[model samples]
Target: MQRRQFVIALTGLFAAHRIAEAAVNPTDPIKIEKLVLSDAEWKKRLAPEAYQVLRHEGTERAGTSPLNAEKRKGYFACAGCDLPLFLSETKYESGTGWPSFYNFIPGRMETKTDFKLILPRTEYHCARCEGHQGHVFDDGPKPTGKRYCNNGVALKFVPA
Candidate 1:
């Protein structure tokens, strides 16, 4: 093979390999198709915070989530699908900008690395509609050792 051709082929092979490694599980490609809502409809359906995060992919101010102190028996549903993602029992105080939960209802979220903060963060979005909720961090009380920090704007509290 010519030197230039060999280099091109090698580069293509490397690029393909990198792309494959960067992809998440095909079965869990952050399914957000189910959560799309009309702007006017969402305006009437959601509070300002919920609408921002669930629809517009906005983030709430850190330490501003009332859910941080929320300690009630209820279900936390997606602001988009009303799909239950976390139970009240798993909720905890992470003192983060969003609600923190130790556990999820299972298979209800998809996570991707976020670089908006100039640091790689595990940003999780609702699995049903791909709404950006918040980032997950490792600093939390243990059982799962995973803090599912969620934007209060992306969730709806349904009291049980």
Candidate 2:
């Protein structure tokens, strides 16, 4: 009973906040400036593999990412628009065969519910370009308890 009430309260609060936010600034999308581009330009900007994942919201093969072995201190950026997505410090070996991060740089990405697989999952994308990055799950490290399962082809690692 308490759990259900708490959930209902949280949902109501979230809806109210979103409504208030829209009333205050309806044009803003998640507080970050949006970037728009032509499909032809996106194809020219990204490689074949990256284009499919970032632009078309496709997933890459698991465990095939060279980024899985990347251990240097740096940040991961969107392959499509070069928007920084995750810092090296937030990354962890989720052992799910993909490069997983505990969190992303705040406001750098946005999320939507994905129903591609029968069960709905949260899908996140680069806020700047709206390029698909990956899905985030609750099973992760202590600090954030989030696993940002990113596609290697959708990201570019930038050393700090």
Candidate 3:
């Protein structure tokens, strides 16, 4: 029947769309200017949680990061590379139980599509070290409708 054929075509189109969404590449291989360490070195350099989050692109549990409560003026840097990723002024209470930021230091991050959760997300990482920081979402405060949801273990706060 025409109805059955139409249904099949629609399903095929939906599948193609999902594939395209997941096809966004993470990062291209290039010579990095900043530090590049082997897996063993990273395991030794970072704490267990930091290594998991930064190196393996793992997310910490919600409401667990002390940075969620951080209110002082400071910079948030990558735990693996110490590259300044965000400023104190950009930090906001997103109520997502994580250290959410409205924006990041320009030129310090690179974004790629992540299909880990089945839905595609714009995941960003440290441009210098290629360490996974977190994903950026559209739901955020004014000026920039981007919420850079970061894992606390992936960053180190430096008080100014």
Candidate 4:
């Protein structure tokens, strides 16, 4: 009984430590230093398509992203600043012809209302570089009913 009690106490301590770590949110843009760069610098650092998507808020054609077919274990990070945005496990086939995710890494993205399409949409960007990644919608599977439709050109996959 004492041993079980000790184990429970240790588990509680571990859980508390993890919760504290989560509270800090290392990727939170307000807390972490943001990466700012000039247009020329960004152009030089990224491909033409990546620049259009990440810097100019351009969307790639639907069904055109190779990342849509990606199935290996990896992280989809911002092509502009290499910030991990989505985990492989969170990825799903939303049939939106994009690399879709059910969730994103906490604090790695920020959202703003966009009206470019004549309708309001929740567009999200990378917290580190403020690069455009994609938009989030309410249509998604369980646990979190949010579909983050992302532009493939704006991301680079990193194997875990």
lDDT of 1 by residue, 1-160 (tens): 9986676567556534532332322222233334344577668877877778877768888877667777878778776655567888889877555688988766778888888889899988777667778778888777989898888768778776
Candidate with maximal lDDT: 4
Winner on TM-score (1 vs 4) = 4
Which of the predicted structures, 3 or 4, would earn the higher TM-score when compared with the native?
4
In model 1, which runs have C-alpha deviations exceeding 4 angstroms?
1-33, 38-45
Which residue pairs in candidate 1 have backbone atoms (N, alpha carbon, C) closer than 3 angstroms, thus clashing? 32-129, 32-130, 62-97, 63-97
Model 4 C-alpha lDDT per residue in residues 78-100, reported as the tens digit of each score: 88876677889999999999999
Worst 10 residues of 1 by lDDT: 22-31
Candidate 2 lDDT:
0.81
lDDT of 3 by residue, 105-147 (tens): 7777999999999999999998877899999999999899999
lDDT of 2 at 147: 94
Q: Rate the local accuracy (lDDT) of all candidates.
A: 0.71, 0.81, 0.80, 0.83
- Where does candidate 4 clash, by residue pair? none
Residue 60, candidate 3: C-alpha displacement in angstroms: 0.5
lDDT of 3 at 109: 90
Best by TM-score: 4
Report lDDT (Cα) of residue 107, candidate 2: 72
Q: Residue 140 CA error for candidate 4 (Å)? A: 0.9
Q: How many Å off is the CA of 34 in candidate 4?
A: 0.6
Greater lDDT among 2 and 4 belongs to 4
